[model samples]
Target: MCDMGQWKQSQHFFEHLLNDSNNNNEDLAKVECSLGEVLQWTGEWSEARKYYNRAYDRMMNIKPTRIKDLAYILFNIGEILYLEGKYEEARDYYERALAMQKETYSS
Candidate 1:
């Protein structure tokens, strides 16, 4: 939907899920990630970063962390930086993601 320029719809749906009282941290993280992706596709890089960072921070507190998910968010953030011409910053994010992915597959 986001790829089809349905950002508003995707954002509304994710935001609704994010607002659910019964939602857990993992659920919130997923919603945040989805919102970030939508914003990213819409060329709202800064806003996308904010949502991605929220998801990253929330995931940090989760036990038995999901490395691939973390890597995915990191990769998205890196792409945002890459698009903004912040190559150095983008490299940092990309390297982190690469390491996580390597670990995920190695073990």
Candidate 2:
């Protein structure tokens, strides 16, 4: 849905998935992150941030943290803050993401 530029449909689909109880934490976290991306596409910064933060927390709690995935999420979080005129906060997240990405990709 998102790849096709169907923002609303993508958001609805992700919301439905989020509401489903069958998904594991890892799956749920990805869905939430995707929903946040959809929201970001629609320019809903605050709502997008909420979902991103939730997804970030869930992903962090999982063992063997997925560094690449975390980097993407952190970058998105930074983007949201940047869009909201929070440059300092955005820089913090962006820096974190950059460090993570560098660490992840350097090896």
TM-score of structure candidate 1 = 0.95
Q: Count the backbone clashes (under 3 Å) in each candidate.
A: 0, 0
lDDT of each: 0.94, 0.94
lDDT of 1 by residue, 21-105 (tens): 8999998998899999999988999999999999999988888999999999999999999999999999999999999999999
> Model 1, residue 107: what's the lDDT?
83
> Each model's TM-score?
0.95, 0.95
Give the poorly placed runs of model 2, Cα more than 4 Å off: none
lDDT for 97 in candidate 2 is 99
Candidate 2 local lDDT, 49-99, one digit each (tens): 999999999999889888988999999999999998999999999999999
Candidate 2: the clashing residue pairs are: none
